[model samples]
Target chain A: MSNATQPTAKPDERVKEISAFRNALIRPELGGIVGTVAVFTFFLLFAFDSGMFNSQGIMNWSVVSAQFMIIAVGACLLMIAGEFDLSVGSMIGFAGMMIAIFSVTYGWPVWAAIIVTFVLCTAIGALNGWIVIRTGLPSFIVTLAFLFILRGFTIFLPQVIERKTIIGGILDVAEGDWLAPVFGGTIFKGLFVWLGEAGLIATFERGTKQGQPVVDGIPMLIIWAIALIIFGHVLLTKTKFGNWIFAAGGDAEAARNSGVPVNRVKILMFMFTAFCATVFAVCQVMEFGSAGADRGLLKEFEAIIAVVIGGALLTGGYGSVLGAALGALIFGVVQQGLFFAGVESSLFRVFLGVILLGAVILNTYIRRIITGER
Target chain B: MTGNSKFHHGDPKGAVQPIIEMKNIEKHFGRVIALAGVSFDVKPGECHCLLGDNGAGKSTFIKTMSGVHQPTAGEIFFEGKPMHFDDPRDAISAGIATVHQHLAMIPLMSVSRNFFMGNEPTRKVAGISFFDKKRADEVTMEEMRKMGINLRGPDQAVGTLSGGERQTVAIARAVHFGAKILILDEPTSALGVRQTSNVLATIDRVRKQGIGVVFISHNVRHALAVGDRFTVLNRGQTLGTAARGEISPEELQDLMAGGQELAQLEGSLGGTV
Candidate 1:
């Protein structure tokens, strides 16, 4: 027999380096980060009018971006798991309506209303999962039906409670003291008022007065968004359930043969998407102070766009919550930046279309290149 | 050249007890008979080659052995004990691992991740779950080393590897998981000459560990090169069995092509010569 040919150390090391480089390039979110940064830089340069493109304007953009970032994180997770949920918008509306109707109309305590809303929203999510799993129907159709059904319910349910177009008391929770410190705490303000009165004010308040800015306080929605993003990131990347999610989305048959419960993973993914919608609904109700059927209209599209732009493949198996967060930031910046750049707000829709198409093309090309299919 | 001499020392022997035995195994898909009374055995540490033309019950037999299909009749015995398997999971647990021709791996997952997928190493802290990625990567590297596979990295996607490397990974996975019976379904069918040799070498390595291997192939040369025992199946029946020394590569090829039947058909095609 001939001598066994061992691979040389130098060539082997080169191969290892190349493989690592290829892996880094092929990561799903890499495209999203590039797209986000590119879009952000484009808008930043275009809005060169110093009057509207200052620090305050940026801060205002961030506040708007935070909301979409929260929703996009959840949407990214759902998309990565290879499913879509159209019912998120409707779930948000229903959840907000529930909180408002219970707290304001029915005179229930704030905490009680919050608990009831979550439970009801979670049940709705479970129902969506059950329906999809049992019938093996496309989530798009299931969630689209859910969207209209929940919209109708939100509209009709309020009339039954108080015959009003708007449901109340939900805003108090958004501004409630119990959740305010965690979710809506004021920044740079009365808490440091004593320091401001003393000579320590300059060291503490370099950017604002009273060693505190009497900002609208941090909105509970922003806090919830950050928390959910972290939680979702951990769930999708580090658990056996997360592995099952990838396997189910990547190749369900292989996963099943490998002993993964494919059905259960799909059910869980759908439920998680619904849970996110419910949480967003609660935050919206709190932030706006009332629930209306129109509260979450078209937000589902926004969430989907954020997820897709964040580096999620429409065909699934690859995505990140962080990428979605960045995508949402990109969207928020563009939406607000256009107005600041003196572009007609009506033309924002056209800009979004271009960005969405461009993102999809870029993602496809990147995938091909990484897989050496190009 | 000599009769029983060839059958004695380093020679052909048909009298050895089978390590894995299938008796009167029958299977049907609705009204179609996929397999009928097919029986075979793989001796321990021996490379048993199963050969058949297309639609000759080869796939059905493999699926039955790998637990993809439960036989409608008869029994499968591992080491002389009758075994019943309900699913591929049961077969795997029973130490029967199948390396399919089309590849049964999720392409996008990393090599190490796919290697330890269903059996992930995990660490739990404060009610939160975390995969032990470091340990998984190390174990995967070790397993690959045993099969002489020098992967670029544990993080490389399985889809990016060469066909032979992928097969090596699958074989290594089987060996690592204590698979005493390795069932390879056309593992070298989709490879170039060099890649085919790599796979054959890997098979040799597997056999050296005293594992019973079932090598299913269409190429008689390839089969004869690695197989110790040969079994030919035609239209859901075992045509014949021969030890390595009992038959030459040409004879095996003829048998695989249905020796007498092919000649009879050729004779019928001739115009009364």
Candidate 2:
């Protein structure tokens, strides 16, 4: 219509060019980016003198952040596909427990145990998605049901077979195990050793391992977090399947009408979420050399909160994996930053609730902007 | 209207074979019959309007034609060949694309993304095939432009467009994807006067490209504006089909409102008056 009045071709005037500020506000990652900056600024101002920025302190929070990052990446994608997996925490505990049972109680090789655990966990994830699709029930309710079921088994099976809810000795069995190192081992050991030798890093002064860097190497957990984030980000933004994910979450009927395989996208997202949780679990059990029934307690909600904070809509169909990763980073920093700043550790939960509410409000506002609705 | 007039009044109906022909189609849902014995045909470069009121089997007839529902009994000939469509996808592959009232678009998605929702353009680098965003964006803008719509940008959200513009996008998408027969289900039912005009103009542009159009609507004036022939349906039955010059708007409206039933009511009330 705008083309009619002007003899010379001009840009369509109907769509008034939005201000740069407003355009930036429309991005799904805005809230996550802002929150990350604010949280980091606050912690840096308050905890800079407390060794929080030191190599050891950085590693401490990075490890914590990586834990959240792993599961948050999964939750972010699944949420974008318009579903939830409330069973992630339970999945972690259950997967770890299964690995322990398979390796320790059954005396299976550690590699076989880890592989079976991954397969079994992914299968259960697929089952979660299948049940949701077949029954037409809300994914929240379905995954909630699994939360209890998996956690119940996590506690029950160990007690029945080993007479305890906690299993240990995995570190010994995992020694020299091929697959275990992928989840449990560290990388860049030579670099850290070089840094320690060159006096660029803090070295243990008086221990049996004198001159070893306090920050030894980058752990596999952090590596997994980075790898998964990159994978999820690429999968969500750069592929045809990524577009289908957005369409499926935005409107399933519309997507289906357009010939998109909505159900398959949703199911794959669910399985990916479960896979992320298993990675977190395996890394945890390897690092700690034990699996407790409560190993991953409340981790699902934590992952969901991280996703929401990263600016993913709880209602689904709009989000960023990068945003979710940053949200996880915020969680890691603040949780450890509290200790460095001498704040109570329990304040982290309170912070989570507050940040989650703020992020949701921001997301709702962004959604309104995108949809041009109230 | 004047620019598009030459093609609008071309009248290529008789010499051309119908792109789609439905003969004696019947659709029954359990005990109720949604459509019965409805015969219709659309020649290339023709807009055959199916006029009906609510519950006049307009929806049922279109659904049956679009492969949403298998007809209880009927023969559908596409391109002079008898065929059965198992689903909407089958119909789509057969070059019959249906643009439903809601348009089946994600509002928050960019126009380019929505245009290529299911059928995305892609390029491969190092064995990794990714969506070719630049190509998609350019094609979307170019297509919209050809349909007389000047989109702000390819990245502009579909929700930001006017209702008529969205309809144009849907129509353009269907046409771009090799749709030989475009079935528009009430494409302008919820638009303002100007928006409706724009959509009608879009329909005219599409028909001139030699695509058989099945324009389903209850609006008599809309049907009369662009349709080469008008077919009226009532109570799951075809009242009749009339070419453009043979049927007046008043007669078309009366037929759509069930002319015999209206005449019977008038006669019954005459004695009392």
- Identify the candidate with maximal TM-score: 2
Best by DockQ: 2
Residue A144, model 2: lDDT of 97
Q: At residue A121, what lDDT does model 2 achieve?
A: 96
For A256-325, candidate 2 gives per-residue lDDT tens digits of 9999999999999999999999999999999999999997888989999999999888878889999999
State the local distance difference test value for candidate 1. Answer: 0.75
Which residue pairs show collisions in model 1? A171-A289, A188-A212, A188-A213, A189-A212
Task: Point out where model 2 deviates above 4 Å.
Answer: A1-14, B1-13, B260-273
Return the top candidate by lDDT: 2
* CAPRI level of candidate 2: acceptable
Q: If you superpose only chain B onto the true chain B, what TM-score does each candidate give?
A: 0.87, 0.91
lDDT of 1 by residue, A1-374 (tens): 11233422123433435555755777667766787778667776877764445535765677677878777876777677677888888888888887778788887777777777777777777788789878988889988999999999999998887898687655554444464244334354453454435544233346554244323234556667778888877777887777777777777777666677877887777777777777777666655677886788888899999888877787777777787887888888888888788889989899789878987887887666544454
Worst 10 residues of 2 chain A by lDDT: A1-10
Candidate 2 lDDT by residue in tens digits, B98-211: 998878898878999999999999899899999999999999989988887777679888878879888989999999999999999999899998788878888888888999
